[model samples]
Target: MFEQLGLIGCGLMGGSFALALKRAGLVKRVVGYSKSPSTTERARQMGVIDVEAPSALLAVSGADIVLLAVPVAATEATLKAIRHLVSKDMLIMDVGSTKRDVIDAGRRVLRDHVGSFVPCHPIAGKEVSGVENADVDLYVGKQVIVTPIDRTQPEQLQRAVDVWQKLQCNVVQMAPEAHDAAFAAVSHLPHLIAFALVNGIASQTRAEDFLTLAGPGFRDFTRIAASEPKMWRDILLANRQELLEQSQVFQRTLKAMEAMIEAGNADALEGFITQASQLRANWRMGPKKG
Candidate 1:
């Protein structure tokens, strides 16, 4: 636990951490700084942050812990702004959806302090966003991946894990590259598919009619499509390389399914559908690759 937590970006992800720390009695004070003044003020009014600093440097002035929860594209700039204030002994972590790019950003901006920056991605969020929507328990029972590089300090890595564990998260360790590849499949690909599916439907002449007749399946599949657009945009582009690979993999499967359907090969089509059904039905919720 730290005496003060310096939070950069007082949005849903960042505000939720401040709320979680306060709820768990972990940190004594949380000083937040967001690029938007109104956002910082909103976080203060929502009781998510104890203090709102005018600048990122002032936010971490004397803090022992710092967390960056900004957009993935903004990681380097945020780190650069506070690099001078980051101390060697301080514990630093990020709640990015992508790890490799974030690690690269740390390398670019943090330089000497890079070892203290333990790159992490908390696999939890809501379709809605903003500091007002931050939930103290958003991270509870959710997966938090810590991807440490060769340059990462052992002590800093352990401390980062401890912090997530304190918040009731299922902490898992993975290599940064593996983390990017896995999430590109499970997380990023799905979001891209959702956005595509929703937009595709809307492009048709009977778009409104199609949507009106849509039911639970459509709703369930496109639930994430309702999420913050800018956030997903950043995520999709940040992990573009891995996502492109995943897309190619998915394309192969889609073509195979289409081939079976077009050829009226009912048995093969059923077998294909059943294979996916069996996998999903048998898969149990447990700590994955921790």
Candidate 2:
């Protein structure tokens, strides 16, 4: 879709995008920058990007499209660091999980140039990270959420959609608030529960023995607990209010289940299990990629 593309991060998601674009011949050249010099060198060695730039601004300079693939906390600072160097003709977009903060940050720095900026979130990732873990088809047929405010231009929105579509993503639109609320329920809450469960188990007696005897169900349920702690911490803090509400709802349900077990209410527990099983089954059967 563009002659030259700029990526500001070379981690899993960023590297994956670079690989996908190259495989699809969507861009003639891909330039990248990362805070860690070693990561930039590694990304180049992995052939994820055609070249590595010395600085974020230099990397994005003269590029037709610039993608901010850094963490949510770094979005505003990255935008400001490259504000003076970014051209008005360049289309800027961020793959941040939360949208409102990023959209507001763009408004502050982009101003009239905001027309070229789009807020987006790709709902695809792996527990592993870095260039080595990046896959060229990571986003193929995966749902990508594009959250645009009233100030977003139609052309810019379409450009963002086209880029993602070229990567073989299934595009979906949502308001920033709604996106945060929904993800809080599905994504954030599950991570929190997984973290809590693992920690809770570890704090008890015979923890090592318990883990040694754990089966596939336990391993699968707690796999997300292995994710980077810092990233999940930032995500939780960014979506605190929504996450808190979801936590309360989850706690109530857990309490109800506990009460049923305590009273030996077999029918009530059976009903709860049936309802939850059906919901999970529906999710598993739902249309989704990989």
Q: Estimate each model's TM-score.
A: 0.98, 0.95
Task: List model 1 lDDT by residue over 56-76, tens digit each.
Answer: 999999999999999998999
lDDT of 2 by residue, 6-82 (tens): 89999998999889988888888889999998999999998998889999998887788888989887888999988
Off by over 4 Å in 2: 285-290
In model 2, what lDDT does residue 47 have?
92
Cα lDDT computed for each candidate against the true fold: 0.92, 0.87
**Model 1, clash count?**
0
Model 2 gets an lDDT of 0.87
